[model samples]
Target: MLPLAGERKNAKGIIFEKAYSRNISRGTSTLKRGFAHMLKNGVVMDVTTVEQAQIAEDAGAVSVMVLDKLPSDVRKAGGVARTASIRIIQEIMDSVTIPVMAKCRIGHVYEARVLQETDVDMIDESEVLTPADEHHHIWKWDFTTPVVNGARSLAEALRRIEEGAAMIRTKGEPGTGNVAEAVTHIKKVNDELRAIKAIYDSGDNQDLIRMAREFKVSYDIVEQTARLGRLPVVNFAAGGIATPADAAYLMSLGCDGIFVGSGIFNANDAKERARAIVLATTFWNEPEKVKEAQKMIDERQSMLGLDVNTLELRMQERGGSA
Candidate 1:
């Protein structure tokens, strides 16, 4: 095993353990966190083909997530949605200089192994795809490649982080083209964080232990989160973001970045909307700039959005609430 720059190896240490353990050398884990940090305030577009991947790169996307089906199509078709074809993932990897990510069914270790071998920069243990293991998620520490997972609350986010997820995205009702669920999830996390922070400020270690037990995560992880006052890793907004305004709105809600899937290719103006969403996310704090991005596309030509309430399946709920 290759030793991380400052990581001293214990012969008995977990193989590849430097990848995620916060208790290990801070430098190693911080390096992984920094990779995601570089994409902060940027947009990560989902692409199915090399052409679309190139378009996303051209539009200033920080990264592109390669997937077999748009979440909406995954919902519409109603079958087991798996990882992208390796051929397509490789083609997209060849096509873009920016980071390339691909999704794996939740807990699908073999699929994730295949993606890691494909040399993709990141892996999303995505709920947008069908779940491969109902009771457990992949043990991400076993791999060298970084992983991102979805969460709806602080407890869920902390659990994924403990499981070695390098990043987190809200598991909003995907493919619906609605932002409400995303907003709700982010707020739920934020509210819980605030509560934990308050408990920390009160100097109540016992209360924190209670919280750790309640969240079913490590006490150290909860304590560290309270110390940082946010997720230790990057947190991005995803699922159902269909417009530039939707992207900016999530940024304002404190996500480090945004992930837009069906919102782009499924629309009438892929190029324009793609560019607009990138601009919106980057300048999310600037209201005037957001308005400019909002005006870049014709709303009539946007994807016919579905209401979250009307959807028969909520992709966000697939991973059993954690």
Candidate 2:
């Protein structure tokens, strides 16, 4: 069973220690993968307050992402978007039973440590926040808590996984309420994976070796990914998903799940929209069901979306050379 919030200890008496102290082995990696596995085919909503967390829980969200501001607000109020206050995170934890994930800026290991200490189910090395270090992302292999990082291409995704990110999400132009960028990103990853699989089927190890070198990841990771024809870790679509159709569209495009940031609370019907997004994500294959979900809220009430081109600060561009 997955560990519960604040349950810090297992029967083995393992105390959550500094992430760097944990031994690097297959067992540890599997632990992170397993946690992400549980959240497959679900929607993770971004929330700011305990009330919002409760609403998300009631709306049937599989998990809630705790942050100080919604992505849209983050874009409006330009500054460092750090982790949410621990006190608020704890209160939200108390308000809901589902897994709670908190964001830490890229390369901010100390912030990640604080989140791990708070016993959040997971940490997001989010590009949506202002990056603390542009040259490097946190060495996630050092942490016990699993991390979900963003990527725009297969190479970026593979590199993050090699660095011990248990899950990956497309770093779509966040806070913009535009799904175009997210669609482009997921398509980019899928196309690259297909290309790699073709090379693998041709019995070309040299190409795989070259790709491994180019991605700065081990050959084993490249080989495994080619063999699987997809990311070894769970993959989710995130950024500016504003509607149920957007959620289902991503699911149809081979994403394991969707992450909604400004879509929910900023809308006029937070409760109805949240519930509809969950339903749409879970029943993505059925067009009728998705239509029903789409009708749950009025488009006029949707958050005023910003054009990706007009944005001065593009959060998705933060991570690396993707």
Candidate 3:
């Protein structure tokens, strides 16, 4: 069963009123696909296991990311799942048809191959909490199954898409335990894209390339990413997403969706947090709601180290293994 609306203590030591989203519809926008219709009114919920995944689906997440294992725990435990157990993977898939995504270590094609046999909808060459076989970019063309890889910058995002990734992400690192890094990265990419567009529209073609490069998009994807203001998925702003405002903020950035990792399950008020975050996406443009939701997050939210450079290096180090 999914996580029910459980009672919990709050500032006044009173049980907080709780509710969960039942889907997103008639929201600020509908989730879009490609450059246009990627699950616009979508949101992602990350779960450590199958039980929580079912809960997320029940609570209205458009999709659920089920980790093979959690990095937060693995940082304490010594090892990682070379591959998520087939039984556990199948359990989650069985529980929900709303796009169950399973993560595997980078370059661990065997794990992905196995997940494919189970009929998963997509593969997230994830580098978050329990990353394995990390790679600079997942080989999208190599897999028959569609992939969603992390992009710290637009260049990486576009390159992955160009390489055949069905979806591209902002690479909001997993288990950073803080939202600031994700926020900063998201802002940088968006700001850079905006600047590039401004310069391009100004007819400064010579400098536009250099400027777009700053945001991380390659020459080809600049045309594509710039064609649309938002990303291609159900763009799920992940990582330190912990509260309703956090989810709302991503929506404000034109994100199609928000992906909550441990944030939902770890919140002091899990059900309320989930409900609020779920509702926030729908009411994203509302100033009063954003004000009310902002208070839920702590001012000191921070993220740990996850230099994509280092991850790229790690991915490169395994070149011979592949």
Candidate 4:
């Protein structure tokens, strides 16, 4: 538990335990509030520019994920921060009333705290790109604000959820400009969860959580939802989301929402792509309406191009058994 370096200290003569207890007891359930809003319409937009964010909002995205710059720093230099300036996030928030999310480099709760001050709706502790905080993952439960983490597999997703992430996504392999990887990963996790529900009743939520903790699950989150209790927020697919059709496919497999990062920006038709995703989520499961989303992206999102191969391998190594 590496405490933030500058956390304000108690007064010199303050009665330590009593004062701390009173304030902490009154602590706000910010995470729950955040989760509710992010899941309101079961769709979220991940965008690299303010213009893209406006497009997403206009198309009815439940939330807008803002970034500073994209693709260039990511493809050539591993990954970099999407929100180049706080002003970019502010501008997007100003442009729309829906929830707005900003990413914080992993293990940097202090930065997350700063974003919280900005009054943004949520903070995604996503490894969309390589993190600035080196190897340390952010401790989700420790923050006063709700923080989301990405998982490549069910176990990993549960691990973060156990650590108190308000929401989780399929780990986005940045700069891939695709969605196939996310599609397959999400499908497998959803299937695994449904199977668990088949084997054990939903009444045993506590039992599933215990198993998750004992086994140290680390990847997919849908596994936990089927095992544990229904989550307060929708489980969504993130990463490699290249088109609206891909978004619809994920929703069909039981995802409540979808997160688009590079997928929306790289299409050469950012506005149309964003609209495709919003509409796909809007009528995702209706067969007749679904066909209209077919060409959101004709190409598949390939995992082979990702820099986070080790992260991918970590989940593949211990593939779950249904």
Superposition error at 22 for model 3 (Å): 37
Write the number of the candidate with greater lDDT, choosing between 1 and 4: 1
lDDT of 3 at 274: 62
- The TM-score obtained by model 4 is 0.72
Least well predicted 10-residue stretch by lDDT in candidate 3: 2-11
What TM-score fits each model?
0.92, 0.91, 0.72, 0.72
Candidate 3: stretches off by over 4 Å: 1-38, 129-136, 208-218, 227-234, 288-322
For residues 122-233, could you state the per-residue lDDT of candidate 2 as single tens digits?
Answer: 9999988889888898878677788899999988998888667889999999888899999999999999999989989999999999988988777887888898888888
Better of 1 and 4 by TM-score: 1
Highest lDDT against the true fold, candidate = 2
Task: For model 4, give the 10-residue run with minimal summed lDDT.
Answer: 2-11
Tens digit of per-residue lDDT, candidate 4, span 1-322: 1211112223121122456446433113333434544474466766666778778888777887776655323555543443446877888878887788888766666677778789777787756444556545666555555667776665665556655666767764555655666777776666656655653574565665565565475323434356453443446787666666777777777776887766666656666567767777788877566566655534443223454453332222121221
Give one clash count per candidate, in the order shown: 0, 1, 17, 20
**Candidate 3 lDDT by residue in tens digits, 277-320:** 77788788996886666555444432233444334222212221
Model 1 per-residue lDDT tens digits across residues 24-48 = 5422445555678888898999999
